[model samples]
Target chain A: MSQLTPVATTWVNGQVADNLPVTDRGLAYGDGLFETLRASHGSLPLLSLHLERLQRGCSALRIPFQGERIEAELNMAASVVGDGVVKLVLTRGSGQRGYAMPVDAVPTRILAISPLPVYPADRRDGIRLYSCATRLSDQPLLAGIKHLNRLDQVLARSEWQDPAFAEGLVCDQQGQVIECTMSNLFARVDGQWVTPDLGRCGVQGVMREYLLARLVERGEPAAVSRLGLGALHEADQVLCCNSLIGVWPVVRLGDRVWQVGDETRLLQSLAEQVYQ
Target chain B: MSQLTPVATTWVNGQVADNLPVTDRGLAYGDGLFETLRASHGSLPLLSLHLERLQRGCSALRIPFQGERIEAELNMAASVVGDGVVKLVLTRGSGQRGYAMPVDAVPTRILAISPLPVYPADRRDGIRLYSCATRLSDQPLLAGIKHLNRLDQVLARSEWQDPAFAEGLVCDQQGQVIECTMSNLFARVDGQWVTPDLGRCGVQGVMREYLLARLVERGEPAAVSRLGLGALHEADQVLCCNSLIGVWPVVRLGDRVWQVGDETRLLQSLAEQVYQ
Candidate 1:
């Protein structure tokens, strides 16, 4: 229980609380969405992007989104945390036993702040990835949303326990590299930087979106296409990105190794600015 | 929230509580399994079958099972609620933020009882099913277990609001009829009783397992095979079964219709005895 006390402060539905009702649909049926943002200097740098995705998830799942209230809460939590991580979990709220949607649903909002995880300082330079056996199921309707139905990710993350591997790489049923267990993947294959298309599966990570937008602004948008595991192995450089970790260039995977490329360094430089 | 007050009693890990810690892995990543058993005369008639499935689910998900503690808590709750539905949710307990399995997870067991729902008495005679647009994803790793990651069923159940439809028929990605939103399907096609194989998707209901075991004992084992919508439409009779609902004779689906056949009535009689 002591190890679980990593959360610095918590708020539930605008009130400070560390417990949710047993009947919350999020815990019952995973009927919810979530956003994990990096807090820096009493502010969430990518709050707008995370909120945009949260709103889209709420719309798709038909859970009422409280945009203004959520924004206010995030800002308040960010101020308290100062420099850490803020996680927002919005659920369809408490419902009677069954799958049917409750008409007068009062959505549950959980906001928690935790000290930023201290990773190896050299992780930014390079990190190794474990190839996970768990395959991401293709559900187009739920694709790209940071929904609470994340057992797939949980299962994948459980495949490895070695500290050497910072994360695990996962693929779909057809062996198409989807994304890492915790981060979105980008690989420079044949001189073109590409990220997996998440229309079929995988969460459209906030940092991945930020990077793509940054690339577009510089008129060198990365290609969003399917990359097979074999092609990924032959790639010049591979990298994984997420809000918390910023970006980690892949230096070793199985039997292959690669030095960080110039483009990866550029991406890392941009990430450093946002995470500063 | 009055409708949500249907629960008669609630117990958390043998103690009466309606709230759980916000950091529970069950709410965080849906890292848990659940069982919904029917309570009759201060006892669960199919407790053994339910526990068997629970043990199997926990083993598959790697969540430690406290068999005796759970059984004791279930019995205690059943005695209190007598004739009703008892839901048991077992989670990997609280953990530090992330998907990694906690080394010393104290599994959370939530046992809740609700009064028997007052459905139309004539519903046992016949019921209609909605054809849901939501397709179950093919995740072999998670197939046939009633895990907390049930957004697919939640989405399917939300497709219709018609009270006339007792349940919804869902299929896999390849259009193979899997099961109903909340029950297991059994149909007699070409004079052969068959239920969809849940190797790729859907929950394997306790009632379905019990019925199959009974059939095997009687030397008339039902074949578990892949069923498509087209073949299902031409079936002689269609039925759905669950612990609480017993067995429901599906009388209508889309333009197709069926009658409460002799075999269905026989199964219903068996169910009546268990639920009596």
Candidate 2:
């Protein structure tokens, strides 16, 4: 673990610990939801957006939402995290040996700050993506929410260790493109920016939602729909977006290569202005 | 959370700590494997079996499994427990942001002992089961292994709050009976013991494997195959098995009552002899 540094600092519940308790439901059963935010100059770019998604996930998981308490903690962590990543983990707290949840559950809130990842400038120009063999399982109940059950992502990410492959685009069981391993995907098809629907599977990305809302507010031709894997190849350009890494254009996916297109450039520039 | 009593003692990475490091991957991404073993009289009844399964899970997840190191720690933990449940959690230790695993990954070993849960005497005779609305997603890669991704089970168990319903029988998206929330399921159909295949979803319980093996050795008629939801209702008897709950005859599943059969009695007696 020496090659990569962990959290710069961490707060468990409200205080620092040697680590979290071994019995924490998050660690025990992956019973939790998390948000990874981009922090710059001691400020979170999309803090509220991330919190909104987390709130939705908490509500879906039936965990009591303490929005004000979370925001207070977020502000404290954001102050120290200047130009880094702030990861917030909310777990169903500790539990006994059974799968049944406790009645009076005190949700454990974990906030951690890590140094910002430095990627090559060329990556923003375009990144090669691997078509992962690990397909996203369809489960409407867990779909769209960034829950802790991320083994599918782990397996998909592990498909290729080659740094040449910056990321992996995965599909559902029926060959429908869901999303990339880490980011939400968008492809310009028939002169419209179309993104995969996260109704059955995939994380309802914060950046994806932000851009969709932005597109709608600005009256841009874009859609969130079921996209087949073949549709991606037929599309004019493919773009991946996430809060951590604003937007990445897909230059190549295996043999299919895409030049930095007009629409992709427009979105990329918009990302920079939005970040600013 | 306060109502549920935590482990009697815990060992994190060979040393006792106030809690686990907040950055551990198990808590962060649910990148871990765990085993809940039955320890009695300062000894684990299924220590080797649990280790075998954990090793398989580690191999599948590409995490280096340290068998001797884990065994040493388990023995040390088991010695102090006397009689209870021993939970061993192995995680791909702390790392920087991103799903790409660290090169110098040091797997964290957590050993915890919790008091044995006291089940009702009538549970052995038969238990009522709730047919959960939460259907298990089909993910062949994660099937059968007791990895930390258990939100499906958590959701299924949460379907019913009534204490009268001891467990819930969950089906996959294909309407095939998978397993109980925390235990493996079996039914005597056509006078033969059969279990739902774990090829798609569901944890392969240690007790279930043990009984299957015992049946094979004794020349008993038992097989693991596809079991649809309708098959459970048409079965002669239903049984639930887990390391913690040895063997529970499931007499009722949502008004579909079943009488205790010869196969269920034989299995119960065998479980007692095995535990002895």
Candidate 3:
């Protein structure tokens, strides 16, 4: 048996450890929130933004947040790998087998560092998208936050094995376009940028939120609009983005193909300034 | 510092361990299947049924099934606690940070034993139901299996703190009644026993399946029907059932109220024969 290097720094009650107690609610009910970030030269450019999102998620879920300890763990993870990906998981800790959160339970924090994923060379050129049939549920309470409950994405990703299809576009139960399986989607409609409103469904991706801010700063009119399937056919440009992968333009959606547009390229360059 | 007994018996590749390696996919994305069984005198009634469901879920998700080892571990868990609730968790095991399932992953198994949760004294009399605003997603692939992704139920359950309201009834995005937060729902409509079809949404509860089979064997036709909020309101009687709770009649649903019915009592007696 090969010994695996300690990839995670786990904290139970303020002290960092190598493992979590078996009853962690994170492992049980997936009672947790995770943040995946790209680190460059032992520092994360959007570290504060990532933490802000994590805090917001915690607040929404009623999970207690320990920002100082989480920051310490992040530093420890970054120190191990100067330039890599750092994944932070905060769980409600161990509890009895019931659904009720333990009254005085201390939350568990886990931070893991790994080598950065190798992005496709053609990612810069643009990516091809598949319109998946799997639809996201509309749960306003759980919307707009990154949580551990991601079965919808897993099922959608499992639908195809063709490496050529970079990602799949997922719609809501109402047949409204929501997002890609892993990334938030944006489209250029009539020379203006528009993205789906995640208030009802889909995750409000960190990078997408950042890009929207950049678009506003550049004096570009970007709207949080509810997209229909017909809108994709009429769009000038389509793109997908997440925190890890800054931004990727969509060159094709099923049979319809479009050349990479200037707006997509501009957003990519702006996100790259912070991501790389 | 005080030491607490571990609530779970964890196994990694056949050896007993408390903490799963930080790379467990269950922790990363909730990539897992779970079976909760009632154990009496070190023997589980309907063990085969639970195993069949687990195997079916694993096959559906393309996770490798190791039935022999699972049975052995379950036997070990049964030996630890002669009578209680036994929960079996099978995760896709450890993998690098990504959604792609590893080609060769030894699935991680967790066996936890907990005392049976105490039910409210009047549960046999009836339970008050709350109409939840959280809508269930229409995903056929995940509808019937008890997978680990359950954020929707968690959020719905968190919506209320009133002990009078036993459980919440959820609906689909189209406003069709689906199931309760953690249990399958049934109603008496037009002198027929009808339960919401799980082909589009909701987890197929093991007890619900068992009761349906018993009803059929007794020459009673229990239809798997699609229900709407209006249908539920018009029902003569309503009940909920799961592995943990044999059967609970609904006494009140907002302004509408139901009384304990003959069919509910008969199903409860049948479940008791198997559980007790």
Candidate 4:
């Protein structure tokens, strides 16, 4: 009933049907990949970046992704929706109850564009983060891919109901800060821009990928590392970034606090440029 | 399109709708619990066991579950689709795009019935198992519940396309044998029936719960432990079970083979009776 109030346009497998077959593997087994791309003035600003990530995710999940079709669809969707977030869901489609993949799997392509969520103005000043008790389980095989199986993130996000707690930081089993409930994390420690390594768990968001490369291109010492709480405490700055939000300066994380630093501001501006 | 054959009746949230809203959280984030029950002469024998597991799973996931509505629905489904399989899917329903639960989540109830799949005559003898390379990720929070997030089993089952191999046995990251892709596993190691502990990962199947209880009642020691490949190889007999396939002796797992032992045979008979 809640989802009945469709906020944006939706297309399923090139058709405008929002009702999917119940047997779709994406529902039965969460066998799929998804990408959330930012649209600006009828064009996907980071189309290539999102498509690249989606392709890699498809390869890892063995979901046959038709890149050309998706690119065309995204462009069409961007032109239609204009300014919002475009969501593309690629699933292995319907299958029998058994876990075995159907001999001839027809992948399902779902494209939806929704109005960008309005963030509170305080978020720009940097939002408060809750250290979620719901830990991200180490799954090296499924790590870094934005697969539909996101119960960990769902559970982590469910931890706090307060609006003040804009996000939650989740750790892997080994106590390494992997990511926020919805974004990838980075902290400047000892003059190095270190993002959490997603080799074990967490999604390497498209924005995070872009910013990491941008930092390196600027001749900044940027690298992926297994970050811990201590790293945040010792860092000069901490921030979280995602395609939808661009970059948010995490000024407060429970008891630990950090002022928005120059590196974070530069990255934010660079990310906004890229997102634009 | 293959699923359009409507061999079974389907009802979505009290309405006879075969198609589900694509926005269903079950499809979105795998936020759901499901039960597949075997019906004999229009009656579900192990309804309590299945319902109990579903309840527990819903509770763990923080999804609202209405037992009374489901019980009435099951009875209605049982009468309509006599002597077949009754499937129940409980999803957090559709919601806004985010991990946060809907302020008012009207959980979706999906009921479908399908004709019981035919098994080969040789199935009574035993089946060979494949040791899949895809390992089940360790997530104690999601362990034991047959949630919609089943990509691990899907990947594992995809490892072997050979129909000769009935199922694939999966392991946790620690290399401990967990369960078959579609069923629970048990091995008579050192004269005790030991099922792999689902403390880390794996679905605690309905048939497994019944078999374990029955085995204990008969004074045949049955327990759960962190089972390893070595333990299975050293076992006198190994077997797999599910609600649909009562109990089948696992005569082969890779190169390690074993005869259908007395314990397995006895359990098979008892399980068959329960299934009937």
Best by lDDT: 1
Those runs of model 3 whose alpha carbons end farther than 4 Å from true positions after fitting are A1-16, B1-13
State the fraction of real interface contacts model 2 keeps: 0.80
Tens digit of lDDT per residue, candidate 3, span A127-232? 9998888788566777888888777777788777888888899998788999998899999998899999898778888888899899888889588989998998
Clashing pairs in 4: none
DockQ-derived CAPRI band for the predicted complex in model 1: high
Error of 3 at B19 (Å): 1.7
Clashing pairs in 1: none
lDDT of each: 0.90, 0.84, 0.81, 0.86
| Best-fitting candidate, scored by TM-score | 1
lDDT-wise, the better of 1 and 3 is 1
Interface RMSD over true interface Cα atoms for each candidate: 0.7, 1.2, 2.0, 0.8
DockQ of each: 0.81, 0.69, 0.50, 0.79
Per-residue accuracy of model 4 over A64-173 as CA lDDT, tens digit each:
87999889888888777778888988999887777777878999998888888999877866988998999887788889998999899889998899888889999998
Q: State the lDDT of candidate 3 residue by residue for B1-276, as single tens digits.
A: 011124435544445666776678887788898898888878888788888889988987778888987877676666566777878889888877777677787788887777778888788789999888878766676778888877777767777888889889998877888899988998889988899988877888889889899989989879898898898889988999987788888989889978888878888788888877
Ranking by DockQ: 1, 4, 2, 3
State the weakest 10-residue window (summed lDDT) of model 4 chain B: B1-10
Question: What are the fnat scores of the candidates, in the order listed?
Answer: 0.80, 0.80, 0.51, 0.81
Tens-digit per-residue lDDT, A1-276, candidate 1: 122222448878877789999999999999999998899998999999999999999998999989998998898888888899899999999999999989999999998998899999999999999999999987888999999988899899999899999999999988899999999999998888899999889999999999999999999889999999899999999999999999899999999998998999999999889967
Q: In terms of TM-score, which candidate is stronger, 3 or 4?
A: 4
